[model samples]
Target: MAITHFTSSNSFQGYHITQQFDFCSGFGQFIDEDGNPASFSMAKERAMQQMLRAVPTEANAIIGFRVEHSIGSYVHSDYNNCILTNLITCVLVSGTPVRMEKDMEQKMEKVLLVMDYPPALPIRPYLVTLIPGQNESTLVQLRFFSYTSEPISALQADIVLRTVFGEDIVLPDIGFARIRAQDGEHQTGFFRVNLSDSLFSAQSASVRIKKYVCGSALREGDVHNQRIDMRLEDLFDLKRLYGNDAVAPHVVYEGGWQCLCGAQNPTDEKTCPYCQRGGESRQVAHASLLRQAEELHSACEILACLQAYEAEHKGSLPLTFMEGLEKMASTERMFGNMKKECMKFLHEHLEAEEAAAPADVPDLSEEDQAAMGSDAEIPILTPNPTGDGDTAAPETEEDRFTIKSPFDDPYWK
Candidate 1:
């Protein structure tokens, strides 16, 4: 049979004066004293007044006050378990002043709500640079990659990253997901920042790199770790410094003479937009390097497919969809293999970034370098393809249990 448990706090029945104590309105009376119950009422008011005086001016009420009166050794047939428990009654109430007790109770409830909700994430230290632009105000794009299984909802993401990195800085609210620059078929999202902000005065007028990971679900007990290596370069247009409405027109060399791309109506003129080298190679060299990296990684798959196509057509490429599908089967196998390999490569790459990152970048102060010897001791970061290092799910808590913070998001810290 399942065992049933009961505590002294539970209700009981019976009558016994094993220990008689009465604190009825407030002048307490023990078995040794025979004080009038009416006289206790005046004492209660006096005690409440003394408590109000101790309360701070701003405090509406003092909470967690409990008074217990017990009459022990009472036995009756109603006491089912032969446990002659004490006849103890506890009267619990807050110590709010008579003048403002009700309003204070309401305020106390509001404080409880705030405590229930998690705190806002602290903005990480970062540098912002304005790439001159006046594009669509809507569709703010923020692209980042993480190795975490627990995905952060759009509601959890902070639209702004504010910090006191160089000077106390606040960045302008720019919309997400607007095209900035294009190279052949490649394009990236534009980031608009204000140049007038004083926070970036001491630092480069350019956006510097600052990396951080998010997700509160990562802190559950006995969790495996997941390293999130986000490639922001893939999402942001690094080369497009000038916007459509740049005050200072871009100047570039064309035919050995410098020219601008967007000046005047170049589209209507069918001429070089601003300045062109006309055959001077419009594509940036860095774009070629990035493309090469992607191509090199996908080379095995692409080559395998191309070879299969040649074999089926006897040296000629397939034109029909059915013929193409047959040739593409070999390529898909190679593609799957390449995808697995690429993830392994990416994991190694992120580990390198983590190792290279400075171990101690102190909060605000620059000179107290001595405080950082231990903090600067860099930990060994190795590639983790499994990503089970820190991605454990959180346990389910009851609805009545109030959590001050959920999901250990670095922002909350």
Candidate 2:
């Protein structure tokens, strides 16, 4: 009889069973990165466990199975953040709970789903550039590499800038979901947004993607976020004295442009006090060297050593950093002559160790082995090679209660 035609007087119990699980909830309202309900598998497992207990004690499995799960959203107050939507997973199943033959086995092929989310974001942020805006504002754009078609939502970042003179400005909560100058195939997801109300007098900016959030996932930007903060070629030493051929030159700054190196120099000393190079010559060479350093380090990535070193130290570069960079410049000259001698010693030591390799096995005496019970004979049971699960072993001359091989178990063939 159909389930719809069933009556309360004639209840169906042994033929089938249904289990309903309590609602399960996870952290986020939307599906996870793999596009799966976060707690579906968990709830389904719980329902299956409950059904197994409610079925007849003699039943081995539920054959005609039907498992169901769904997602739902509801607004609720969360202690961690503002009011947010809660995603829930509910599961239920109905099946014919029956006891199968002891030797039963299904040969049908089944497919299981596996998913991987190698990267949290579909696009990798490559570069962020800022320029003058149309209405006395700042226009910022973020260039990114898009390898997947998945859409990223609620993408926001925090950018810092330097205004004219020496004032700093921060543009937090900036949106970069707008597609501009983007080619998903050849180029990337170039995102742009006009800061309608920005620092109009900002001359040059120092931009880095220090913080960003994608969807509901909180992630920190990589150190390479400053791919092009402020190009060295565009830098200007702008406090010119008189525009004559040589009537005073270079920016007349109070602290000077040696990354604030010469702090001991007089307040009026625009440049280093001990430098011999002319003002114009040193400024131009320093700017050129910066560009060359950036270009060279892009390929070798040697500059990352200092950046990582600084982070490891948890503050500015150590005193050893400046002293070591200057002293280690000629380390090749100091170590060049010792290479041959060091290699020869290393080779000889390696060969000696190889020639005198130690044996791995133990070398215990025969009498010691016998005393330790190593020579005792151990009885082993042989598995029945060719027989159905119902086949019984012939009566053995040994004890009747002797342990049997795992293959002889009633559940096995």
Candidate 3:
């Protein structure tokens, strides 16, 4: 139940609190629409969230709520050389922490907000937060809230329910172990997560949102969502909508199932010949996900570079670029050769960019250095024969590309 669902008497109140409670005041300043704090209710919600923190538990509602808000503008800059104004909203909320009655709070619940940044990624999963849910011997609720326009009926991701003792319970069972959307048409999804006995024995547990292979940020130990604490919102955001279902690898079966490693094997085969993975091995899926993420990331980088080049040239890729790309990509794509080709292309491109880059300025002459103390408006540039403006009076090496022909560079016997 939501705080809004709480009526005057049917208030946001219960006995079992959602998270570990602290006595901190709820107050925050947020940049919101002008004169329209209602346009963004999240400002108020942010203030209330400081009251509760993730622990081995979950709370359904809040009680004894008090909220205050103000919307106003501040002079970011004043007239003279800079005059700018911006609007901001401040929300202050205070609430007595309470949990649902035993009937309602028996099960702990964790809500992960679905999000996408640096858009066009193939897989975007709900957060794997620090305190995802309680690991105690009890059924826990897991929820995904996506402010997506269209319904996502089929979405899947591999999740590892890690215990406090450093044991990971892989969701291998296709039936109940998957972290995926509800079977039918739905905008949001929920699951009653069941963990192993070993996990429950530990004090607390966390959900590990695996993306080390997909993005560089996560690989460098940066927070996946750019924040440690996961934010949960009850309201659906219509203006900011995300309805992409390429969240994970879709299950495909062609007579015999395909391995995550992109290899096609017959049903009788116990292991994949290309990747050497067991037919029922979870490692196959896990490794496949990582490889897919890496490929997607590499593709994005190459695509961005191509797009930038096209934008600068105001048209399609230059003939030479296309020819070079075709030649580089002529290498085998299966296995890991594709990545090597991409790296080779990038290395060559870097050399070309460095050659086109401007040369650095030269140090002042002995006489000019001495003249620095005087009011001498010393010239920094001189025209060379090239007629192009540069810091030097003489031409450096002209940018050149000469590929030695195999037929001419060395005589073949």
The candidate scoring highest on TM-score is: 1
Q: Tell me the tens digit of each residue's lDDT in model 3 across 159-241.
A: 45544476656653111122223321121122334454454334222332333221112322123332112122211111011
Q: Which is superior by lDDT, 1 or 2?
A: 2
lDDT of each: 0.28, 0.37, 0.38
Q: Per-residue alpha-carbon lDDT of model 2 for 1-413, expressed as tens digits?
A: 11221222222344333332322222212333334644777677677666555665554444446666677776666688777666666677656544433322322211111011112223334233444433443445443433332223324555555555677676665654333222231111222334533354454443343443343455665444312222322221111111001111233356543311111234444343322223333343323333343344221232344445456656543455434343433353665433333323323433344346442233448886876575543223232222121122233565233432312323222
Model 2 pairs in collision: none
- Candidate 1 has a TM-score of 0.22
Worst 10-residue lDDT window, candidate 2: 109-118
Backbone clashes, candidate 1: 24
Badly placed stretches (over 4 Å) of model 1 are: 1-62, 72-290, 295-299, 302-413
Task: Return model 3's CA RMSD, one decimal.
Answer: 31.5
TM-score of each predicted structure versus truth: 0.22, 0.21, 0.19
**Candidate 3: deviation at residue 141, Å?**
44
Q: Write the per-residue lDDT of candidate 1 for residues 1-413, one digit (tens) a residue.
A: 11121123312133111221222122232221223344334444454444444544443322234443433333444446564432322222232221122111111000000001011121111122222223311122232212222322211122232333633333333322221111111011333343332322222221111222224332211112111122323212222221111111223343232222223332223333322213122222222223333454453544454455456556333245224333434465655545334433433433344355443222435454565454553221211212211111122454112222211223223
Q: How well does model 2 score by local distance difference test?
A: 0.37
